[model samples]
Structure formats: structure tokens, C-alpha cells
Target chain A: MVAINKEIVTLDPHLIGVDWGSTCLRVFLIGSYGEVLATRTSAQGSSSMNGSAWAYEQSLEQLAGDWLQEYPDIKVLACGMVGSKHGWLEVPYVACPSDVNAIAARVMSVKGVDQRRFDIVPGMAYRPANGVPDVMRGEETQIAGVLSLRPEASQRSCIILPGTHSKWVQIEQGKVTAFATHMTGELFAILRQHSVLGRLMPSQQNELDPIAFLRGVEDARQGMYLGFAHQLFAVRTLGLMEMMPPSSLADYLSGLLIGHEIQAGLGWRLAAGLEQAPLILVGDPSLCAHYAQALSHCGVLNASILSNTAPVGLWAIERATAGVHATKLAHKVNV
Target chain B: MVAINKEIVTLDPHLIGVDWGSTCLRVFLIGSYGEVLATRTSAQGSSSMNGSAWAYEQSLEQLAGDWLQEYPDIKVLACGMVGSKHGWLEVPYVACPSDVNAIAARVMSVKGVDQRRFDIVPGMAYRPANGVPDVMRGEETQIAGVLSLRPEASQRSCIILPGTHSKWVQIEQGKVTAFATHMTGELFAILRQHSVLGRLMPSQQNELDPIAFLRGVEDARQGMYLGFAHQLFAVRTLGLMEMMPPSSLADYLSGLLIGHEIQAGLGWRLAAGLEQAPLILVGDPSLCAHYAQALSHCGVLNASILSNTAPVGLWAIERATAGVHATKLAHKVNV
Candidate 1:
């Protein structure tokens, strides 16, 4: 489905960057001037495609149908769980110390509907000193975006992507040196939604109480007397003792999980002689704010949040591969 | 119901011990000599009684139908979740530094279906140095049984009751001075049954592989580089890496949870200057063995398992109150 007049389409949009994650698909339309022209998002994630490669293609085509009709030759750059084993096409992980260029170089291309090209970015694998291998999918792109936006971050920084599987990544010279994954978010969700602790949580939705959340962080920080397993029970005990309200239970749990994560992640960094390193928090604003607050509680004064870096990261990776693909298209048009 | 001839029941059986828990009800028929004449068990626990006091009484009557007929005047001793807030009757917890006598003195009696005496033992509560209030119900009775069986356990012993919410109690001079609860077993079950980690486990039931369990225990023991939240992901990673089979995931998870529990429990005990104290493990045999294995892995050589101490503890509590109750009953008979 290559257009006869490739020159005409080349004058349209430069790149269409997509972050196809496990549960959500986010797309960014980048103009020739490297600016975000338009953006779109859908609930059709890798998981919802139901393991069918064809279903993923159909969903992608449907999602990008209107844009493709206007700019038929726009190249698509994708990242995250869309490249996982359970995703449409499995992409191999680039072992750390990997940079944006290294990740961009290993991008796997799959034939999209009507001859459109889809470039899927590879994730990063980290084997820490503990010998257990840790991996991250979508966060690598965010990290790439962070490095792209702030080149100063490349010198030495800890970028934390807080979410379901919160990641603590160490970057040096724009390369991810090492990283660890904490199941804090997932654990908090499950405990609050499915465990006995759920019974004590308020039925109605309540805005996160910062006071309660900080108290939880304090509980975890000062809870050297007991491990997390034991400290977790305090959530219920405190509720039973009327020390905290039912509505605050969620925030408290969130604080406990996030606090414990920071303690472990930062503690490791401190032990490894990176005590003075700058920290960058990345994710949704609310989540990032929580992390920043937790960091402050731990006396980490230099932490800052990088707001909405996934699109920037996707655009950066797309830019790396744009020249090569552009040359190929130019040659085809001349022929 | 009380028999018309009180002498017959007094001759028949002196005590009927019941461990009415959240999900199961266990009853022990004790002769005047304190030997278990017969036993009965059912799934009609406090939870199954569905917040109805009448349902609990009816369920109790049905469970002890034959025993009640034989010895209508038999004094009943009950413990466990039966006295919880949502149980048949909410019995107040006896604050710690509580022994068999203290617990027996606070035994709550409920009006039975007819004239039978239903005596429920009070649970124990401990506010540790960390100032978190911890409570245990049936396990305290088991601890009482441990103390009854081995009086030496009364002097600076750590009694570990391994189950859904495992309790580690510090007993000094036959008194439960303090205790802590670990959501290890509950956490393991939820992680395997509800979390994403369950996806890597086998669907079919497989026997607990000791080797795999020990590996998990070793992983937790040596996982100082990360917290349990981070190390838990190793279960999924190891499965994905093919380092461990899907079938062995259950056993491995068991090891990790139990290992973490022991580490936290024993670590606290050790910190409290009980490093040389003997550990008395009281629980079901299978669960006890796993804890024992983990304890052994942790280099604790003085650990012993106390199998099925509920009956002994129940009998002991019963004996404590038998004289006073009998004297009251004789007074009634004379009147």
C-alpha cells in the first residue's frame, strides 16, 4: 500500500508516537517542527487485544483511522507493554547500561494495516547486585524522555516512575545503569480492594488526606521495630482504635507502601555511595506529588517531578529513526 | 439442656471444649478425667453464623447435639473468632501479662439454647514497645496449652502460632507479656490467589515441594538488597526465567512468606534480648513444619512443634473454673 507519490505524504506529519501499555493506549501526533500537534488515547491496551496479533493491528488501525486518512504515510513509534511477551509482538529487552539511542536502535517494526510502519521500542532489563533480574516496559521510554528533556539528568540521577509497579532507576551519562522494581502500588491496590483491610476502608470515594498519608509514611519510616508485614497490621489496629478514620485508610495505606518503597530504594542508593545524587520523580502529577512528599519526609530535599515525559520520550525515539526511514522513502519516491 | 438428674451428667463428662473459629468449628468432649471422649468438627464457624447470635447458638446446639444429649450439664469452653466483634458474642480482650488464670477469670458465659453453660475464653491483647496494639484469640488458648504442656515455655519463650494471621507471642513466667501478628499466610494466599503473581503459578494442586520452599526461604533470608515487595517479584521472575517451575510456585511462595515472617518475628524477639530463648511453635502440623524448616534455615536450633494444643488449653482452662462452677452447681442442686 505504498503511495505512488511518497513526496506528497512526506510533507504531512513527521511521526506518530504511541505508548501502548498493558491497560491504556496513548498516541501523540508530532508535527514536522518536532512539536506535539495533536494527541489521542484509548482503552484498547495490549491486554484488551486478547493475545491476538490481528486484533492489535485492527485496534491500532481503528484508533489511528481518522489521522491516517488525513496523513496516510505517518510513521508510528510505540513503546511499553505492547512489546511484552503478552503483547501483539514480543520485543527483546536491551540489557542495561542502555541509553535512548541504544533502545531506539533495537526497535522492532511490524507491518501495520495498509503498509503503514509500526516501530515498537524495546524495554530495559537490569540485573542488580541482588542477582534477581528486574525489568520495566513503559517506564524506560519515560526515562528516555526525562533524559531528552533535561540533558543534565544524564550526568547522575535517580528517576522514579511511581505506579502499579513503581521503578527506581539510576541513570548515568543518559544510560540506565541499574534499576529495581517495587510492587508497592499493586500491593496497595490489592490490599485495599481485596484484603481484610478493605473491610475497614470507607465506601464512598474520598480525596486523599495528606495528614493521614504522612502519618502512614511516618509509621513506615519509624517502624524499625517491625517489618512491613507486621506494620501493615497497624493499619487495621489504628482503625480499630479510632486513631484514624475509615476514609483515611486508603491514604494511609498509600503512604505506608510509598514510604517503604522510598526507604528501601533510597537506602540502597545511600549504601552504594550515591547519597548526594539528585532524584527525579516521574508519573501522573498526583502520584508524583505523593512521591515528592515522601522524599521530603525522608530528608531528600533535591527531588523534582518531570511532568508528562512519555510523549517527549516517544517523540525523541521517533526522531532517532526518522532520518533513516525518510531517506528510504525519498529513494522509493525517486525510483 | 441440663439433665433432670444432674448427678448423671456430673458422672458423664465434665467439659466440652470448642474452638469456634472464623471458618470452622471444632468441639472436644472431655470426660471427668480430662480425656477426650469424642470430638466433632464442622464448617459452621462464626463467619458462617452470619452475624446472627441465634445462628451461632443454633449451630452450636446442632454441632453438640449428641454430646449435649449424653451430658446435658457439661460445661462448654470456647475460644477463637467465636468471641470476635462479628462472632456470636463480642468478648473484650484481656490486656497482656495474661496467663491461663487471668484468661479463665475473664471467661464470658452466654445463655445456651436450653440450660447448657457456654463459656467463652477472652483473647489477649498486647501493646508492644512500638505502641501498636496487637490481639489474638484462639492462638492464646493454644499458647495456654503450650504453657500447660511445657511449663518451661512460661519462662521467656516465643510461641509462634502459624496460620492465616500468624501470632508470635513472648511468654514470661506463664504470662503472655507481648505479641505481634504477621499477615504472612494471608498475604501469601492473596498474592497467589488475587495478585498478578498468581498468573505464574500452576492451576492444578501440587504437593508442597520442600526443596522449592527452602529455596524461597533462602531467597527471603538473603534478600537484604531489597524489601519483601521487591523480592516478591522474584517469584514471578524466577518462574518466567524458568529457574523454578510453575508447579513449584506455591511451595516457593510459602517459603518466601514463612521465611519473611520468621525473620521479622525472630528478629524482634532477638532485638528484645531473647536471642537464646527457645521457640515453641504451636499450630497445624504441616504449617508448623514449614515454620520449623524456616527457623532451622535461620540457624535457630532450639525450636520444637506443639501439635494441636487447643484441646489441652481448653481442658486446662476448664479445670481452672471447674471447682467454682461445681460448687455453685452443688448449691443449686441442694436448693
Candidate 2:
């Protein structure tokens, strides 16, 4: 075991938290007071590192080598795809309705070079009312982080993590009761890049046109004779007729996809008599904003954006596990 | 004008009918009685010939070189994508409700090498109840062909042309009244090739498994809480669970897409109080079979499959135009 430098432990990072996903690697160095001292992000995601023999440890050292050298005693905590089957370790998912404690208890640890300790938070698996199985890797940690940060969120809330595979999760009493996944972003990407609709869109553009997007949202909300498939064709026809400009076609397509996702996901919950609760939006801010706008269009007025919940989630799990270890040691001393 | 050989026109051939689509060129040499005396096909579709200066004439001569050499007096009639804006020549769309004669009256002619006559049939366009404009090129001719072949179809019928852009047309009194286009096949292709869903599917399969496809159809018909977006993720989840074999995933995906399309397309017609008339399916036989199965699953049992409608439709249009020309000549003589 490496010697722990007690004097520097207080001033240096007490914990190194990571939110590693399929396409990105983000690390946060946190002080004893749970404040982030330094952070680093890289594009070395699980997909890029899958072929390496020791991808997890190699990628971690590559990103945080200098920080680790400066603070060797700091403990590392990671959540997300790092624990998936294709990631660092294949950590089995904790079946739902899982709380922070349950997830904390199931945390798996690995030893890197010089006996450095790495604790990985396991993902959550859910079997919804539909009987189809669903799994989420990184979002569970975000939910835990959100619960820890916002005390009122422990009562009840619907959390949405909008990204490639958008996750709609429900939390009651600080436990994840149920959640579902939608391939909204992925579908939109493929359709826009590889399908016929791509022909009408401008090759490159940064900002989205609000009017075109809202029009798409309005069309989806109407829920008339045209479904998503039929409505998609209208994007091309309207573009051909010069009713909608080619540059705005991408934004309009974005609105249609997000609109349909919201209608199917939240609309079902609304139909089931679920009361209106402020939705916790997590993930990239730009993507979350789109979801928030779509939710508002659907009359969902209460949505709060939560940015960078991954570090908080990892910190919470680390604290819970450390507390459990401390309680076990105290019990032994008493005996 | 090229000299017309009387004996060859009466005995050998009178019309050269062509079905030119985005990906294929099919030509039929028809005799005086509208019987197909010879046939030829090539991969010279509109998309393949888009860059050529005189693609329409060049592709025709390439496919029917020998036929044209033997029957120099033959009048050529072409339909399908050959008349789109990006095609050989842009023929204006005849707005529905339009009869066979109305479509024939708008036929545009082009002069090729050596004064060869090429008459192009115009496609049909419609504005449905939703006020969105829908158009079809090749299928319009097939609908006219179906009406000619099945005389009883003149009263009223639903014609389905299943392909990349599947057209669902409604005909009343031998005229196309309304129609809608669904991007079902395109969606399926893109999802299977470029999306994450493709990862769960097997790369190669010779035939579709009926059992797997029917299960997807059943799932779609159930209309459970899970919408199309949600249900799409199930394909991946179910595959990971080993509940669905990778080899059969393609067929299942096909059924889900086609099933949802049928539910939206024909299901709307059913909801509109239109009585069940046998849906006249015009397209490739194998593709029609899959649609036939899906329609049967939806309880629309009366579906008649019309194979090679492109040639028949071209023949019918040629006959109509010839009769009109003869009437105008006789009227001039009477005056």
C-alpha cells in the first residue's frame, strides 16, 4: 500500500470523480469540502478505448497523470459507461427501485498501478410496466446527485437526460422507481445524415431557427392524421415547394423528433394521471434547452435545468461507501 | 419525322412502353392488341442518369436497341420518375381528382436522334384533408393500369404502391381522388444501415422469418403505452436479452415499420368511414406479399396484387392518346 500524506490530504484533492461515457471522458478533482478544484475533459470515450487491453486504467492515467502524481493519496470515483460491459469493468446493474445506498453498496473497485484505488458506480436496470427491460449506465448517478443537491427532488420528480439515447426517469422518495429510454437523438442524427431528408438540409449550420422548430413542435402536438413517418416526408415536400428554407430544414427536423419523443414519453405519463411536477433536466445545456422548449410547448411549464451532476453523483457514492466502512470499523471496536 | 412502316406498325409492334424509376429502366414492346411481344430491362434509372446530357434518349436506346431497329415505326410511351424535375424532362403534375384521359391529355413529347418520338406521361399530385401536398410519379400509371385491368375498380378502390416512398392512393369513378406518401421503406433502410438498431441485426439473411415478423406486427397492432419511438428501443433490449435472435431482427424490424405505416395510412381511411374495398397493391411481388401480410394482420383481408402494372399502365395511356388523336383528326375532316 502507498503511504498516505495526511498533511496535504486536506489542501489537495480528497477525491477524483469521473463521468465517462461512450464518446467523452470528464474528470473532476474535488476538495474535502466537495468543491471542485480542477477539471479535465477528453474525447477518449468508451468506444475509442474499447480495443485497448487495459483501456480504463490507461485512459485514466493519460488524462489525470499529473494530478495523480501531485496528489497520490486522493481516492478515485467513477460512474457511467466506465463500468459497462465494454468499459473498464463489467459491473452488473442494480435492479430498480434502487436508491443511493443500494447503488453505493454495489460499488466495485479496481487496483491500478502503485495500488491506486478506483471505485466504479454500477448502472441501473429497470423492467417497466410494459415488461420490456431497459438499462441506463451514467444517468443513475445523475439522479442520485440531483437528489442529494435538491432536497425537494427526493419527494418526487421526473428527470430527463437528453442526449444520443435520452433517458426519462422517475424518482420517488430518493429512489429511482422507473425509467424508459428513447433513441430520439440517434434517430434524428441518422435520418438527417443518411436518409433522403438530408438532401434538403444545408450541410453546415450552428444555430437553430426558433420559428421552424416551434412549427414542427406544433405539428407534432396536433396529433392529426399524419404520424412521425408521414410528417417527415412533409419536411421534404415543404422544402421543395419553397415554403421552408433548406437552412431551416435541420431545425424543423430536430423539432419533429424531439416533439414526438416528448409526446410519447411524457404524454403517456400525463394520460396515466401523473400530477404535474417540475422536471429535472440534465446533460449538455444546449440539448437540455431544446427538451425544455418542447416540454413547454406541451404545456409542461415547470422544468429546472441541472448542469454537471456527474461529479456530485460520484462524490455522494464515495461518501456513502466511506461512511459505511467507517461504521463497520466502529462496530468492530465496540465488540 | 421518321417514315412509319405500315406493315411493321400493324404486325410487329405499335408501341414501346417504358417504366423509368429512380433505380431501374423497364421497357415492354407492345403489339397492336396491347400484348407484350418482347421486353428488356436495365439499371439505367433516373438517379444513375442524372449527370448525362441526354439520359432519357440514351437509356431508352440502350435498353431497346434491337427492338427499335426491328420496329422503327413504334411510338414510345414512358412514365414514372422520368418526368420528375430531376428526370429527363419535367412534366407538370396533373392535380387529382384526375381521370386517365386527363393524364393522357397532358402527355409531353420529346424528339430524340433520327426524329424518334418519345411521349412522357405526367405524374399525379394531391392535397389531402391535412392540406399537405403529396405527389406520385410511377404509381399513378399503375393506378390507371389497375383500373383498366380490373374494370370493377373504376367505382372506388384503395391502391397501395409499396417501395422507397410508398404511395397510398384513393380512386373514385376511375379518377385518383386523394393520396398520401409514407417514408416507411426509407426509414427502415436508414435505421437498419446507419442507426444503433442496426447493431442488433444480423448482416445477411436470405429469407424473412414469418414468426418473427408476425410478432412485430402483433406488437404494432396492440398499440400499447409504448409508441413507435419507445418500441424501437425494445428491438435492441430484446436482442440483448437473447429473446430475439439477431438473424430474425431484420424481418421483425420490417414488420414494425410496415405495421405502423399500415396503422397510420389505412387505419386513417378506416376511421374515415370508408367501406372496405379490396386494396389494389401494385409493386414488386415479394414486397407486396409482406404488405399483404401486414394488411391481413390489420383485418383488411381483401388485397389484390397487380404485378407488372407499369407496362400495362403505359399501354393504356398510349391507347387513350391514340384514340384522342384519331378523334381530333376526324373532327377536322368533318369541318
Candidate 3:
């Protein structure tokens, strides 16, 4: 993942950065030079909104209107949870290689039974060509957008898109080949606020202590082999001195969660052969760095931090399209 | 556990039953045998009073005087949480083989440390020859008393003591040979009230579906080969229709937790060995029945219930020595 030149954020006229999150909806209006003319935020988050039969129109009017009303017509591209089944609009799920065209073709902008005009971005879906089925929502759009920027990153890279439900997508040759998600954040919250350990926890956001967090990782590896539940008892009954601070226990829970995911997602390789390929971790620098640090111990030496490219990659869908294709993807113009 | 023909609510010349639970202290004065002469309960729970100190004397004099005023010289055998470290009196933990003699030997009574004349019962202590260390509190006394009633239960009996912390102990030769405890009840409360599943669950307490509860047992078995943290995700995400009712989730979680203990406790057995031994389950009959039913599926064929034997067991200590040994177990006793 290479750093973008200074002009990238400023000069992409067709660029549009959209953040479709679990709890918030946000869209930024960018100019031909990638300059933000305006931004829109809404209370309805991804999981809460409907298929947009009525809502899609209202949110789109507010979001796309900020720029559309002025330019009265500059074409735009959208990404993120806006494509979810419950978003402002329901974008059909697309299987990956998942270029702008595949997703763009699935966009729906028809006035619904309620008479609303708004376009929906589509997400990526993966079915077992061989194993269990899985799906990805807004992240694949960003991954494609990310790869579009760095063509070299199109092959075999791990993209960590973090949030309450963070995803780690495996991209190969310009498409989101496969991926898995971890509910790390949610688990951390539950453990800290709800478990017996709650008594020992201090009320404050805690930092991940590299020293302590690593112990958790070690314990998970040791403990996963010995039943994590009983081992949890060991933490308390061993006495306060031996028990990791409730905060650290939180981290241990997180590590154990991710470790189990790695076990499931990686399977056989986790058994002493995870070196099949290097791992690329995205999201916030600190967390990705922590995951990378732990993965390193498991023998994955190359861990790169992918840019928080969700916004950049999301916005790039416009840049990746042919001018004719862009116009064609939109509602037919009437003059 | 044996059942007495005498009633618990009537009055006679005998002493009443005293229930010293972790949270409350209750004294019941019954007839010479087991008839309730008169009953009075108080808030001076086991932990609230200082070591068989002044508070016990003041409270007991008033409480006992309520009914025992007639007999005036009746003896009282206290049981339950009062024998804990925080109870009116701290009784030393008796080692296994345990019986009334050991319990009677450890009884301590002080007159308010200056005035109260009450002998606090002692629980049992167990340190495995090889295994993680743990301690038993009130359950030991209950088990000992129950053992006294069913002497043959000594050889190959399984005791199920349920509460905030539930323990399953295997007894052989009239001794609590080995045991494992799971905080099933506490975990149930925490998960139902605080975790994300809290959303999926209905607020009202409803009966747990045996199917769901059984699924929890099945899911908990994942502990043997997988970390529980991940296994829980399956329940949350897939929303196993079986484990859906939040109320039953407790029962299910209990099944899982208890099942884990049973497996761990009996892991050394060869195939098809669970049914080979007799099992004695002590607790609320209903809950004990559920546990026994679950164990039966795994081939545990012989499980019997122990009636309300906790108090009787404590009293057996007094009956065995006729209160003579009470003063002897203390650092020094004056009566």
C-alpha cells in the first residue's frame, strides 16, 4: 500500500467519499479536484434503515442534494453500507472481481412504490465454490477502489477494514477472492461491561498494553488448547496477583477471539505453516499494528498497514469508470 | 438426604432449624424432634456479624427468646453461609472423610466474643493431590450432612451443589474425593442481562426450552476442542432457534457449564463409562433433575436427588457430639 501524492485528496474532481458504518451514515461531496464542497451525516445507521422504499429518497435528497442542487447535475458515485439490504437503497450483492461495472450495474435508482429517486451501491458476496458461505457488505467496494489506486496491490493482500464488525478480506488479482470478519470490538465491550471481571475493571477506555496484550495472546494460544473457560477460572482463583488486570482480561478475550478466528480462517496453516503468504492489515494504525505484531509471532513476517482507504477507495469508483460508462450507469438524462 | 416427619412451622420443646445463608441469617425453633415451635428470621446474615462476636448474642437472644423462651435452655445448630469467613463465626475448614466428628471438632462459639453462645459450622477443604487448587465453602457442610443420612452413598456418589457457584463433586469412601465448580448461575445472569444477546431475548422470564438447553450443552462441549468465545458467536449469529429464549439460555448455559464440568471431571473414563457409576445429585430437586437428565443422555444412568439436607447435616455435627465438641474446636471455649 503506497502513500498517495498530496494532490490525490485535492485534485480528483469526480471523487466522492462515503462512509457507511454500522451506526452512522456519512457522505462527502468532492469536486473535480477531490475538494470537499459539503458533507452530509444522518442518524439512521446501516443496520437500522429500511430497503429505502421511503427512506432512500429522503436520505439521498439530503446527501446527494447538497451538491446535486448546486451543480444541479454533477454525476456522483457512492459506496459503503448504503448498499446494504437495509440502507438508503438496497444494492444487489455482487460477486467479486467486483469491479466498478459489476457493482455499478446492480445500482437501483427507480422511484419505488413510494416515488423516490436514489441509487444504491452493491456489496460483494461469496458462496462456497467449495466450503461454507459468507458475504461482505461495503468493504469490498473499498477494496476494489483501493486496488484501483495501487494496481500492484491487486494480488494476494489482506485488507483489514475495522469497526464493530471488522473484516479481513483476501484479495487476489484485482478481486475480493475471500474474507472473514471478527466481532472483536463487540466482544471487548461485553467482557468489560458484563462479566464477573467487570468488578475488577476500571471505568475508562484502556490502552492496549503491548506487554500485557502479548501475554493475553500467549495465554489464548496456551489456553485455547486447554479450554478457555476453565482457564478463565484460573485467572481469578489463582488470586488477584496472578489475574491480569480486568482491562488486560478484556484484551485477552479479544486476542482469544481473534486467535480462534485465525484458527478457523486459516485452518491448517495455523498449525505451524502460516507462512503461505504475507498478511496486510488495515484499519486504525494501532490495532492493525497489534494484530500484525501478534501474527508475526505466528510466523507471518510481512504485515503491511493498508491505508484507511475506505473513503479513498470508495470515492475512486467514479474515477475507475469510463466517461461513457459513468453516464450510462446513471438515470437517463432528460433535457 | 433424609426427610424428617416433624413439621417446620410448629412449636414444641425441641430447638428450631437455623438457616445461615450467605445473604441472610434465619433461625427456626422446632419441637424436640423436628416440629416448628416458633420461627423468627433476622437480617444479621452470616457475613454481616463480626466473628461470633457481640452482634450474634444480642440478635440470637432476641430471636431465640421469641420461641425458645419456653424451653429456655434448648440448643441451636446453625448451618449455611454463617460458617464462612465472614459469618458470625469463622469455622476452620475440615478435610475430607469429614463426618460429624471433624465438623464438631472445628465448631467455635463465643459469648459475643464476649456474649453470644453459638457454634458456627465449618465447611470442608480440598486440595487435590494434582490439579489446580480450589476451595469449598458452604457446600461441604451440606454434602457431609447428606452423607450422614445415606451412608452407602459414600462409595461412588456425585453431589450437585447449585447456587452462584455450582460444584459437582465425586465422592468415594465417605469422603469428598474430587470436585469441579462452574459459575453457571452467575454467567447466566450476566449474559441474559448484559450481552448483545440481551437484545434478542425477551425481557420476561420464561421456561427454557429443553431443546435449547440441550443445545447449550452441545455447544458447551465445544469447550473441549474450541474456545468458548468463538462458540458463543455461533449462538449469537446463527441464533440457534433452540437457544433463543433468553430465560432458557440460563438453563442452557447451565447445561453447557455443568456439562463441561461433568466431562472434565470424568474425562479420564474409557468409552461408554459414564453410566457405570451411581450419581447423587444434591440441590433443588427440579434443577438437580435437569442436571441428572442431561447427564443421563451422556450415559450417566444412576443419579438420585438429595432433599433439603444442608441444615440437617450441620445439626448432625451437634447431634453427634451433643454440643460437647463445640467448645473444644474453638481456640478456647467457655460454656
> Which candidate ranks first by DockQ, i.e. highest?
1
User: What's each prediction's TM-score?
Assistant: 0.91, 0.90, 0.69
Off by over 4 Å in 1: A1-12, A323-335, B1-11, B323-335
Give interface RMSD, every candidate, in order: 1.2, 1.6, 4.0
What is the C-alpha lDDT profile of model 1 across B162-241, one tens digit per residue? 88888888888878888899988889888988887899887787887999999888888787447778888888777766
User: How do these models rank on TM-score, best leading?
Assistant: 1, 2, 3
DockQ of each: 0.56, 0.51, 0.19
Candidate with best TM-score:
1
User: In model 1, which residue pairs have backbone atoms overlapping below 3 Å?
Assistant: none
Model 3 chain B is weakest, by summed lDDT over 10 consecutive residues, at B326-335
Clash pairs detected, candidate 2? none
> lDDT tens string, model 2, A70-162?
877878889888887777777899999998889999999888766878888999988767566888898988887777677687777788888
lDDT of 3 by residue, A51-92 (tens): 544664456566655455554445545666666555666666
lDDT of each: 0.79, 0.78, 0.57
lDDT of 1 by residue, A64-91 (tens): 7777677777778889988988887788
lDDT of 2 at A215: 83
What lDDT would candidate 1 get against the real structure? 0.79
Tens digit of per-residue lDDT, candidate 3, span B153-261: 7676667776556676767666676655565665556666766545566677676678866766666664444334434544443332232545555555556666665
